[model samples]
Target: MRVLAAMSGGVDSAVAAARAHAAGHDVTGVHLALARNPQTFRTGARGCCTLEDSRDARRAADVIGIPFYVWDMAEQFKADVVDDFVAEYAAGRTPNPCLRCNEKIKFEAVLDRAVALGFDAVVTGHHARLGADGLLRRSVDEGKDQSYVLAVLTREQLDRAVFPLGDSTKARVREEAAERGLAVADKPDSHDICFISDGDTQGFLQRQLGDAPGDIVDGRTGERLGSHNGAYGFTVGQRKGLDLRVPAADGRPRYVLSITPVTNTVTVGPREDLEVGVVTASKVIWHGESTSVECDVQLRAHGEVYPATVTIEGDTLTARLTSPARGVAAGQAIVAYQRSADGDIVLGSATITASAPLATARA
Candidate 1:
């Protein structure tokens, strides 16, 4: 089978390509140049689209004796992922850029190109399993499972995708890379957004959207506590950097309860106020024709998956968590799963449109 392995200049992708080649499959390495100015973003021996990373991917492809090329997808990436991120935050929603990138760039744009170019499938280093039934499953390595971010992929996309690292743990992957003599085996994982060099999200937003002053209000009393440079700088559940002078009545720490971009007001309350159970999501995407299912829902990546029943109505989805989850924020992707007789299967995901406070915690 002809496969286009998406190499991100990392150990995982390198090993994935190597394994695919060793398995007697025709494999070609492709590095995505997603950033226009690579130097503006920190490479740090991690992250993709760096000049060093592109060189590393080329070297790895040479080591594995495969043809490799760099595809420039910077324009599409900025329009779809980075711009959408700014717009989501400006509209008071917390957007996941990685998920958006997978949906818009990797699976959609790159995969389309690969298929049109006569490749059978597109492979990546995503830590998610694809079953014979054409369903995406959780990775064996739970700690490194990236199935949550990939929950947005459609059935057709899953049909032509391969995740070679799904069955292996991060440690095992590094070991394999070491055995293969790949240089990035010991590189630390990238933390910040690949395009954001200084790790200053606020500065990036300010550069995109002019600074808009706002007021920070107390959630309970609706009294002004402090002023903020911009509402986009704050996120739900954030506590520090608020610079609020209001003293807590019981001396308990406060957390961000909500962000109202229309009024440019950020509300802060006791941490307990962050608990929520009901979430409404829009732009819902189910893998198949199934509309509704009782499954576990994850509000954020690496967050605990909670028991919930997801009901689809038209283009929206309502997830009622069996128990309240803290820091449930709108604009995040809520991934659903179904508990099969054997274990669990991913249902789909939707962008969180709205969230209502739990009944007991309602103001």
Candidate 2:
């Protein structure tokens, strides 16, 4: 089988490509140049897709003895991941850029191109298992599992995907990379948003959306408590940096209950108001047959998983969590999983549109 390995200039991907080559698959390494201005992305260990990262990926591919190439995906990435991210935040919602990247850039664009180039599959270092039964499952190394972001994939996409590091832990992968003489073995893992060169998300959003001064209203009292530079700077359940003029009568720290971009209003209230029992999602991507079932619902990447009663109708998905989940913001994904003897299998995923309290949803 011919495989196109996505070398992200990281230890995990380097080891994954090496393992694919060792398995006797004709392997080619491709580094995606995702930034139009490479200088705008992070320079050191905090981000990927920089010019430094591309050079590192090429060197790793050299060590792995595979044909290498770089694909310029800056325009597509800006449209799909970066632009979508800013738009979602501007609309008063939180978006997971990693999930969007996997859905649009990696799996869709890269996989399509690989297949067109006569490659059998595209291999990556994502820590998620794809079983013989064609089910996507959690990695054995739970700490590094990435199934939440990968749940957006369809059955056909999974068919043409390969994850060589799913069965191995991060430590083991780094060890293997070092053993293989890959220089990125000790390189620090990328952190924060990859495109945010300074790691200051609020500052970055301010630069993009500009300052839209708004009022921060006390949700419980309907009284204006303070002013904010922009409503896009806050997400649901954010506590610090509110800079409110009035303190709560109860002396409790106020949390952002909601963001209304249309009115440019930030609603603040007690933390209990953030608890949500039912999540309503749209644009669902279910790979299963059942319209309704009991499963685990993960609201965010690397976040908590809750037992939920999930139902699908048309393009909508409703998840009623057995217990309340806190800080579930709109535009994040709700990924469903079914437990099995092998592992937790990804059932599907959807973008959350709203969340309500248990009583409110029941009513």
Candidate 3:
């Protein structure tokens, strides 16, 4: 089979491409230049699209004896991931750019192009697995599992995608790279979003959404506590940088409860106020033909998965969490997983449109 490996100039991708080559599949390496100015983004020790990263990818490809090329996806990335990120914030919703990238750019755009160029599949270093029935499964390395971000992929994309490092831990991947003499074997992981450098999400949103001054209110009492430069700069569960002088009388730390874009109000309350038991998921994409079932729902990356009963109505999914979860945010993806007769499979994912307190609490 012909494979096009998406190399991010990192150890994981390097090892993925090498394994593909050794498997006797005709392999080509492709690096995506997602940022126009790589140096502008701090990229920290772990980020893709740095000049050094591209150079490292090229060197690794040369060592692995595969044809390598860089594809400039900056414009597309800006339109899809970056622009959507700004728009979500403007609407007072927290957006995950990595999920957007996987949904729109990597799986849809890049995979489409690769198929058009006659590649059988597009391989990546993502820590997720695809079974023989084309079901997506959690990576064997639980700590490095990335199946959450990939829950948006359709059945077609999963059919033509390859994850060579799905069954291997990060440590084993590095060992494989070293055994193969890959130069990026010891490259540190990228930590932040590839496009944002200073880890200043507020600054990035402010620059894009402009200053929309608003009042921060207490969620319980509806009392105005302070003023904020922009509602877009705040997210649910955020506790710091509130810049409020008033302290809670209860002595519990306050957390952001909600952001109302219409009123430009950020609501704050005790951390317990963040707990939620019901979520309405919008723009849902189901991988399997089944429309309704019980599954494990993940609210955030590395978050504990909880049991949930899901009901799909068109593009909307209503999930009732078996137990309450804290810090559930609007605009985040709620990915569903199921344990079938075969194994664990990703059912689908939906954007969290709304969350409400359980009926018992509300009553």
Candidate 4:
């Protein structure tokens, strides 16, 4: 079978490509230039899709004795991932751009094009496994598991997805890269949102959304507490960088309880206000059958997996948390995981539409 390896100029991808070739697959390497204007070369660990990254990918293909090429996916990336990210935040929700990339660009855009061109599958370095049953499962190395992001993929996409590094640990991947004479064996992993040239998300959003003066108010009371240049620059559960001098009467630190984009209001209150008892997940995609079941729901990328009873209705899934979850923000993903003898299986994922207080608390 012919394989198109998505090389990301890192040890994981380089090794993944190498392993694919070693596994007797007819493999070709391609590096996606995702930035609108990629630098001549990558400087530090903050940037992705640098010209240097492209060169590194080509070199890896040479080392692995495979053909290499660069694909310009910048416009598609901006429209699908970056623009969606800004829009979600503008609507008073937190969005994960990486998951968007996996859903829209990597799987949909790349895989569709690959299949059209007669490639059997699109190989990636994501640390998730596509089992013999065609279900997506967690990787052997839990610390580096990336099933959450890839969980958004449908059953058809998983059919043509190949993850060569699912079983290998990151440490062993680096060792293999060094042993294979690949230069990116020690390259630092990219952190935060790759598109953000600077790590400041607020600064990035401010530049795109522009200034709109708004009130930052206490969530409990309607009293105004402070002001902001733009409400789109804030997210729920944010504790610091508020730039407000006001203090609570009890002298306790405040956290962002909610962001109302319609009124351009940022609501602040005590930490307990961030607790969420129920999550309504929209745009749900479940690869499994049963409409209602018990599973582990993970909110953020690195957040704890909590027990949840998820019920699917039409196009959405509403989950009742066994224990309240804090900082449950809208626009983030809620990935469902079912326990299995092999590992935790990715049932599906959804975009969080809203979270409400527990029924018990109201009662």
Candidate 5:
């Protein structure tokens, strides 16, 4: 089988590419140059788009004895993932860029190009399982499972995807890389937003969307509490850094309840106001069965799962949580799964459009 291995200059991707070669598949490694100018992005282990990362990927491919090439995906990545991320936030919603990257850039664009070039599959180091039954499942290493981000993929897109490091833990993969003479074996894992190397997301958004001064209002009293540089800086359930002038009458911390981008107003209230019992989403994609099922829905990446009753109709999906989920935000994905004796099977996923409080949901 001919495979295209995506080498991200990280230990996981390098090891995944090497393992593919060891499996005797005719493998060619390709590094995506996501940053138009590498100098603008962070260097070292902090970012995947740096010049250092591309060189590391090339070195790994050379050691693995596979043909290597770098694909210039900066324009596509910017238009699809980066621009969309800024737009989502500007629209007063929290978006997961990783999921967008997987759906639009990696699986869609890269996979399409691979198949056109006669490659059988595009393999990556994603920590998620693609079962023999063609269903996506959680990795055995739960701590590193990335199924939530990858869940946005369509069934057909998932068919051409290959995850070589799904069953292996990060520790084991690092050990294997060391044995294979891979230099990135001991490299620290990338954290935070890859594009925002300094880890200042608020600063990053300010740079992208610019400052749109807004009012922070108390949700209960409808009184203005403070002023913010931008409403895009806040998300649902953000507590710290509010800088409100007035203290709450109850003397409790106030969390951001919602953001209205058009009005440029951010509403803050008690933490209990963040709880939601119903999550309604759009642009649903089903990988396995498409029936209305009693399942578990994961709202955020690496977040806790909630038992839900999921009903799918057309392109819409609605999940009613058995227990209220705090901080349910719009534009994030709600991935549904079925807990089976075999494993937690990914049923489908959708982009959250709105969430209803327990009382409103029941009514």
Candidate 6:
């Protein structure tokens, strides 16, 4: 099989490319240039798709003895992932940029191009598995598992996806990179939002959407607690940076409960208000032929899994969790998984539209 290894200048991707080559696949390393003018700071995971990252990926390909190329996908990426992220935030929703990148760019755009160019599959360094049965499953390294983000991949996309590091731990991956004499063996892993390399999400959004001043009111009392430059700066269950002066009746700190973009308002309340047991989602995509299924629901990347009973009808998905979840936000993913003898199988995912309290939903 001919594989296009999506190298990101990290230890995991380097080893993944090396392993794909060792497996006798005709592998070619390709680093995605996501930014027009890349940031090449040696300042420890400053940015993904940096000029330095592309160089490191090329060096890894040299070590692995595979053909390497840098593909410029910056224009498409900015329009799809980055612009969508700003729009979602402006609509007062907490969007996961990484998930969007995987959904729109990596699997959809890259895989489409790979297939068109006669590559059998696009191999990536994501810590998730695609089994021989064509089911997407959790990786062996649970701590480093990335199934939550990859759940957005459709069945057809999963068929052409290869995750070479799914079976190996990150420790073993780094060791393999060192053995292969890859320069990125000791490089720090990128954890921040790649595009928002400065880590000022609020600042970035303000630049894009401009300042829309709004009142931060109490959810229960509807009393203005404070004011914010933009409602998009806050997320459900966020506590700090609120700069609120209101003291709760229980003398506890307040958390963001909701955001009304139409009204330019952010609502705050006690932490208990954040509890939700039922999630209604839209834009649902299932991996298999089943229209409905029972599975555990994962709300965020690397977050706790909650037992859930999921049912789907067209684009509507309803997930009833056994327990309450905190900080359930709109525009976040609700990934469904089934525990079988084979392991945790990623059944499908949807975009959370709304949530209700455990007691309220059951009532």
TM-score of each: 0.96, 0.98, 0.96, 0.97, 0.98, 0.97
- Ten consecutive residues with minimal summed lDDT in candidate 4? 39-48
- Candidate 5 lDDT, 270-347, residue by residue in tens: 999999999999998886565688999999999999998999888889999999999989999999999877679999
Model 3, 229-304: lDDT tens digits are 9999999989998987678887778999999999999999987788888889898889857777888899988888
- For all candidates, the clash counts are 0, 0, 4, 0, 0, 0
Of the candidates shown, which would achieve the greatest lDDT relative to the real structure?
Answer: 2
Candidate 6 colliding pairs? none
Model 6 C-alpha lDDT per residue in residues 114-204, reported as the tens digit of each score: 9999999999999999888999999999999999999988888988999988888888888888888888899988887888868898999
* lDDT by residue (tens digit), candidate 2, 56-105: 99999999899999999999999999999999999999999999999999
lDDT of 4 by residue, 1-363 (tens): 899999988888899999999999999999999988866555865655778788888999999999999999999999999999999989999999999999999899999999998999999988988889889999999999999999889888999999988988999999999999999999998788988867899899989989989999988887898999998888888888787667899989899989888899999999888888899988989986898999999999878999989999999889888998999889999999999999999999999998997655345
Better of 1 and 2 by TM-score: 2
Clashing pairs in 4: none
lDDT score of model 5?
0.91
Please give, for residues 1-363, the per-residue lDDT of candidate 1 as tens digits: 999999998888899999899999999999999878855345475357788888888999999999999999999999999999999999998999889999999999999999999999998988888877778888889898899999999888999999999889999999999999898888777666777767888899989888898898889999988898889998999988999888888988889999998899999999889988789998887874567777799999888999987889998998888888888788899999776653357888899988877883344
What is the alpha-carbon lDDT for the whole of candidate 3? 0.88
* Stretches > 4 Å off in candidate 2: 39-43
Which pairs of residues collide in candidate 1?
A: none
Error of 2 at 52 (Å): 1.1
| Steric clash pairs (candidate 3) | 42-197, 46-189, 46-190, 47-190
TM-score of 6: 0.97
The ten-residue window of minimal lDDT in model 3 covers: 38-47
Model with the higher lDDT, candidate 3 or 5: 5
Q: Report how far residue 11 has shifted in candidate 2, in Å.
A: 0.6
Question: What C-alpha lDDT do the candidate models reach, one value each?
Answer: 0.87, 0.93, 0.88, 0.89, 0.91, 0.90
